[model samples]
Target: MQTTFTPAQLENPHTAHSEQIIRKCVHCGFCTATCPTYVTLGNELDSPRGRIYLIKEMLENDRPADAKTVTHIDRCLSCLACMTTCPSGVNYMHLVDHARAHIARTYRRPFMDRMIRQVLAMTLPYPARFRASLTMARLGRPLAPLFAAIKPLKPFAAMLRLAPSHVPAKAAINDPAVHAAEGPRQKRVALLTGCAQSVLDPKINEATVRLLNRLGVEVVVPKGEGCCGALVHHMGQEDEALGFARRNVDAWMRVADEDGLDAILITASGCGTTIKDYGHMLRLDPAYAEKAAKVSALARDVTEFLAELELPLPVNKTDLLVAYHSACSMQHGQKITRAPKVLLAQAGFTVRDVPEGHLCCGSAGTYNILQPEIAATLRDRKVRNIESTAPQAIATGNIGCMTQIGSATQIPILHTVELLDWAFGGEKPASLAGVEPRVEPALAAAE
Candidate 1:
């Protein structure tokens, strides 16, 4: 692959960065076999190599995004599986992100597409507003059929269809400032109570606190921490995303400066990937650049941190069989492939891998809502492979994957931490409340 950016265009920071990424590609079509859209739509334009060419053309010409380029780029899930598969080590994530930001600047979308994108940008990154909007979703759900029939408003129909009919009570919002370690403190770390995960499944936070406290790790919920900006960042809302990034850096830096943090533990793998990249995202900001790099250094996924702690093996735990669905962000984006499954096995559960583990489950942030038809195709394909493992429950590290996979399967879904938490000393998950807890005989004898 070749880029023809003029010397003047190459002087621009974004163009310079994209040029570096583009030059790494060797025109290998290995990426096509792993790309979800290419596999489903069978369009060369839908694959990474095709999109790279489109991006290279758009950047080199320094012109507005055309309909063909926008269509192919918008369909991309940004799963980063191609990054994992590429032997050349091309940085597709940053390249795609830069292309999206360019699209946001130059593409003039239709009225409905603009409105839908606006609604998502304004609401999803803010939890209280999102909850309020969800409250009104019932009124819109009835109109889903009508919206779906419209040419440009089908994503709006998908949004209404995915909205939960009943919002849970607010008691479990998990707003406590700090949870003290149950015993002598071994480490003190801040926990990211992110936007959507807190609203969608607050219990994941609770379980995290319990497991950390039991392990003698004090947990601090930084007051000003909010969304990780991943939801908006991937949408090409560059300034808004950077704004959220800086605010969170300020919030978390204050805590680290005052008390000291060994690690910043995150449960949501999608947020973890973005949080870990705060360094690269803010590299050009002179003021935030150093602080963002420091924050990224301290960030760690819960499973990553737990693996460091070398958690004690589970005692008297049932021999539960679990199909571990690795989130695309976890396995591919962050390259955290084995820690979660290893933790599951160490916690006394039989962990099995899904067949197409490298593929995205169609829950790349807002990808599902924005591209419902293609998203559904990938989701069904992912579910079939997961179900073939014959497991009693599914375990994952991402709330988005849990929501997407849960919609398609009746199998009990647990956050990897939730299962690990309960297996040690916490209460059994409500879904498994009736089942008696017992240790595997082989595990018991070994212990």
Candidate 2:
């Protein structure tokens, strides 16, 4: 894996990073065994080795990527399972990210595909826009069959089917600033108000706040913090992603300056993974680079921080079987392998591993909406594995995995923080009661 980069190409930061990653690979096929696409499709082009070759050629040639390369790259879930399997220490996450950004810049997709990607990039990262879209999806759910009749709109229709009917009305605040019921607090953390998570399940954030406060960490939901840009980044909208990153960095930095923040906790694994990489993502930016690095250092997954604190466990132990679906970002991307399960066990739940836990649930940010066929296949596979575990409830760190798995399985899907919250004295999730909540009636139809 040698690169002969031109002087001009080396001048570009992304190209230089891509070149370094290319040189690290020795064409070892070990990563293919754990790659979800290769495992499912049995196509070499879908494997890490194949993708590396594709990316190499695409970058080396400095030409717009052809449809074949775009197809193979698009098929990737960006789960980063390959990184865990690779003995060569190849940075597949960064490499694939560079490839995605290249594709978004150079590739001209078909009309329908472009439309879907555009809609997702425009809506998913904005809470207000996503909320409005969900309402429209609910009203339009009855006409799903009609929408499905059109080839271009079928994916949209399927995505609509997955939408929850009633999202929590607003973000929840559970710290001393908002909730006085919680006694003395030791640390004050600002919770990231994720774009999709806020609209889809504000309860997850509510659970996060409660769990943190119970652990003596006062949670703060800063007024201006918005999407973590994870969705747009995966879609290869780097500018939009970085813009969101800078805004968050500034907002959190302001909060830190004012109140002396301890850490920024993120409940969603995908967002957590991205926010932690802000230092690298903005390393080249002149103005916000230093600020981004500082903010990135302060970001932590809820479980990661809680595990470090050695928080007091709940005395009441419920004999509930739990299937832990480790989000790809948490396990592979962030290299946080066991914190969530260990936290669950300490909270007194029987945690079981879902088979093929390394595979993505097809909710790779905007992946489900943009690539429905492949996404549906992967989601079905994840659902089947979860069913095999025979667990009373399913717990995961990322909101995307929760929703994706929830759509495919009958068992209630709870955020890892939610279970932690419940164990510490919050109410049990309604879905675990053997009856799914009727608010998302469309989900009932999905079952």
Q: Model 1, residue 217: displacement in angstroms?
A: 0.5
Q: Model 1, 223: alpha-carbon shift in Å?
A: 1.3
| Candidates' C-alpha lDDT | 0.89, 0.85
lDDT of 2 at 285: 91
Best by TM-score: 1
Q: Clashes in model 2: which pairs?
A: none
Runs of candidate 1 with Cα error greater than 4 angstroms are 171-173, 434-447
Worst 10 residues of 2 by lDDT: 172-181
For candidate 1, give the lDDT of residue 226: 89
Per-model TM-score versus the true fold: 0.96, 0.93
The residue-level lDDT of candidate 2 at 216 comes to 74
